[model samples]
Target: MRTSDAQTLIVEKNPNPVADSERDALLLNPVFGRVFTDHMVTIEYSRERGWQNGKVRPHAALQLDLATLVLHYAQEIFEGMKAYRLPEGGSTLFRPGANARRFRNSAERLAMAPLPEELFIESVRALVRIDQKWIPGGDGAALYIRPFMIATEAVLGMKPSAEYLYCVVACPVGSYFKVGSPSVTLWISDQYTRAAPGGTGDAKCGGNYAASLAAQAEATREGCDQVVFLDAVERRWVEELGGMNVFFVFDDGSIQTPPLTGTILPGITRDSLIVLARDMGLAVREEPYAIDQWQEDALSGRLREAFACGTAAVVTSIGNVKGRQYNFTVGDGGAGPVTGRLKDALLDIQNGRVEDRHGWLDRL
Candidate 1:
């Protein structure tokens, strides 16, 4: 259906909502991606009817057929975003339009029906408005919103499904990583590659993440927090982390990230930082970064800092790197000055502590 038609969505409140006291207790220390809100948004699509039956309903399990296309073929895509409780006692979203566009791109790549950008934004807004109370007001805490689409047709064919389901759910969350060190260590994987040329690497689909589990486990076994993957072709050029994009700060007062060449997900957070860094008078360059060069620069004091950016983590400093053959530290094995500055700048804009000159905030 058209976006205008989606404006008149049906509302169905949850009958057994969480109690205030219980919810408050949960919010006091809401773990990331665990405690969910009360309601969820859903919209269905079919070849004949298109998108219809848009509604906000109670969060519950879906009864799908055993032969569902998505269950077998993995025709699914999703987006990650957050709703922040502003300092002035209101709510806002950070560049949700960008997320909408990326969601459409991902849907197209997966051969699924693309939901209108307005419909995607409106669905997220509707759910956040209904469950606004679930938003945490503590430091570094906000409501995490997840929007996804899946093929729901009851068939086992190798083609795209004729039916689809689009859904949005929210949960209160704190830091994605534990609050211990100001920087995180990464393990580079030479054995597994994240994406190859002309693959689904640019799409934010479930399959890309599923393919990284083995590498991620290898990182964990190596006593590291996260895994950094390289390009599949050369296995030398740095691509990105499992779920986030990577950036390197050179000693020459410039910033560099791997170019978006259909082998890396175009992250909204990464885009924001590029603008913000430029605003701070730092030259930002999108180019190929070799893993060997990364280690060489780090050890030779040419690379000053490095960080990973995404909707969930925001900006996290990468202190050290460990590979099968080489080991090195980034700028004294701690959060560098540039990394801290960039993190604070971005957070200030997101949490409403500074002026949003770029008009990235959408109030609700």
Candidate 2:
């Protein structure tokens, strides 16, 4: 609950864990979020008991009442991160402190009790350390860590639930989409918008993502990899992909992304790339990028490349854009030199192949 109370974690090993060979088979080519480890961490909170019963226990199903608040009201928040298997034997987490802070911010936005930053990070560490054997290696594989909080009070009221449950789970994962293909095609959504000016767009809550499913399904029907949403008011400016932030590379060796105006989610990977791009001597700016401008620039050779960034996808090139009025390709419809270099740099630092100039990795 607090920094001083961080050490109250009680760990219970699983009695019947998955066999090593079966885990190895799953790790060979694990699908994202499908294969989980043996253990999980959970913490409970309430008004009377601020935070209690912190434990790293065997993974199992939760016994939630039918009238649970989160089931109907959706008072929940979550954070996504990864634990990379270091080349030198151990494993390391990437920017976990940032994730912890973001989790707190998301909790505040959702009106849920925010867990202490130390406790959040410690929960992740406890689970990943106990399930370290589940972390995959090579081919951009790692252990995907999901930390989430949900309202558990059995009430049917419209107010925030008094009781809450925070849990951490880990899964071995490969590339988010697939291997080999490092780029994606996007379908611009003119009918649906992700968030409005004064909405929960900035929060990492389930409702926001649930709202994007229809658009994503539309993208699938249109034969595209992902959907790109526009501003809710004008439907002109580019906001972001369904789950990732968009970046544009100009012919003048500059980078621009949609500014965080409380509509676009402030992604941790996006922030890290802004710093990394600037450190590489590239001019970076957070500006409002319009869809028509993007089309014109790409067709006129001014927009050299575009890519999306997030915790899951890491960095993926945007090969082409498909809209109702116009369609265009970005720089030969493949990964550009800048995107490749940035991706490699980020991966090198994450996988322990190069020096961590920014100290982003927390080794376990």
Candidate 3:
């Protein structure tokens, strides 16, 4: 990778690489998050030096202080994206610049120093370029790239920390929530909310997800795959799943997802899905999808399909939604035709099986 505008830090390769047999076996199942690539990218940010000391180092334990601001106040943000092995033996990152922009936005939201777009993209490219052999090539597998920033300053005050750390880590993996392919169940929780109306929901911070873990546990207990959260205040309108955004497909060939109303994560996959849907000649709507409408339409088959989109899960078919005492099964309580078609099309583009008509793929 070559970049004239920024300085790059290079690290020596890992001497103790994964054994050939062990790596082959891991690629067989390639359970998600089970293993990580040999190396990662890191860059530190401070008020004095800005972004400095960029490096592609071996993946190891970070010596973080116990009194770090991230531990005390949770000033952190993250972005999830992927690298794919192209058909011609090379690799690419899908919408990596978009993720870089989102990473900066999340940093701004948390009052942390934002890394330059070029620097962020360069660091990610450096990692993926060197780790190309580690990128999984099987069906429904991908190189999951997690780029995150954390408040590392060991201050006790409630304000944002002065020192921060940014890093990009990659993992070769399988499906995130495997109930089979893209079909799964979810429970809408009217009890605990995901994001408040004016809260930090739009930012990809750790606390937002940390707050949803309990609800997710509850959803699992109720025989659901994931938990969907309503608005935090009045708890009326639909928001999203803990880690994914929700989408509704109508019988009239229309698609709808909740608007980015400052209380929900504006997912990169959600944006790409909307663009792809429009390319497929579907009338896509970005309006507030209420909870009651889901129940009413699913009962009559007007809501033909329901799905959630994210970097990890790409496109997941939501089978049913159970809100405490109320339960509604969508589209025969399984993956609908529309959902399957969209998921297949999206995956084809991601995996280089279909033409990236929307210019979504970034070739390495």
Candidate 4:
């Protein structure tokens, strides 16, 4: 019933939505980030017009400028969130408005254009309203929405572009972690740090992600699911994973994570878990947890659990962290009690199985 930015958009429905049975098969084994929803939302920005030409059009290859700033300087930013289909007929957006707010923050940090919070949330609403059928309502499945912005100027300057474009693309995806949310092995990279002091680590940009691919590839070579980066200067503090934020639950019922120290992605799910844990009478501290603590705690059983959280994975229990000199495994090397409970509690609130205590669910 609550609508925000509908005034700016021009809706054009997709003529060819993926057929139901075919879509169902994709949902059954939905490969992450491969398939897409029928439509995408778009808005163009220029120095003169500001933000205009907002539309929801069919998803297809974009005709981009050859000298686009995004192509050359990689002036692009993105946010990832999901829309769940409730047991009732209607669909729901899980804290998508939060994502929109973060996207604006990212834009401001990038010196790119800030999508007005109302416009950002409204574009999502219109697109989801039209493409409600694509939302996978079954078990561990939902429609993943990727809202992105790119510098679209035809000029070949090294500076920020005068023109930019923003869009939201949806994909129906199954659980990000296969094997039913099992523990993941993390390959710690002392070689390439993800974010430096006052760097793009706090912002969700392509370069930060592009900078991690080689480290991620090395992680894959070691038979690990993901890569965790250390602080750029010291390589001592735990920063964040390539795509998610890290959390450690201690045996004493106190939860600690790497504080927002200008060199990490402040994930929305990470923020939610902090609130959720505190609501359940757990002490959650957003402090700089050293890597030595991770190893020592795991060795002593004091580190009860380790999990990664993001829009994609939701919550994945970490099995082991392998560095060059040492390798550590925690809590039977699988999903621990705290990890399981947190995942279920978050899911229940999103799926409408429980009450929306924090007002995160927005029904479509």
Clashes of 3: 0
lDDT of candidate 3? 0.85
Best-performing candidate as measured by lDDT: 1
If ranked by lDDT, best first, what sequence of candidates would result? 1, 2, 4, 3
Give the range where candidate 4 is weakest over 10 consecutive residues by summed lDDT.
1-10
- 21-130, model 4: which lDDT tens digit per residue? 88777777777899888899988888887787888899888998687778888889999988888886888888877888889889988999888888888888888888
Give the residue spans of candidate 3 off by over 4 A: 1-7, 179-182
Q: Give one clash count per candidate, in the order shown.
A: 0, 0, 0, 0
Candidate 1 per-residue C-alpha lDDT over 26-126 given as tens digits, one digit per residue, 9 for 90 to 100: 99999999889999999999989888999999998888999999999999999999999998888999999999999999999999999989899999999
Better of 1 and 4 by lDDT: 1
Better of 1 and 3 by TM-score: 1
Give per-model TM-scores. 0.99, 0.98, 0.96, 0.96
TM-score for candidate 1, please give it: 0.99
The TM-score between candidate 2 and the true structure equals 0.98
Comparing 2 with 4 on TM-score, the higher-scoring candidate is 2
* lDDT over C-alpha atoms for residue 335 of model 2: 96
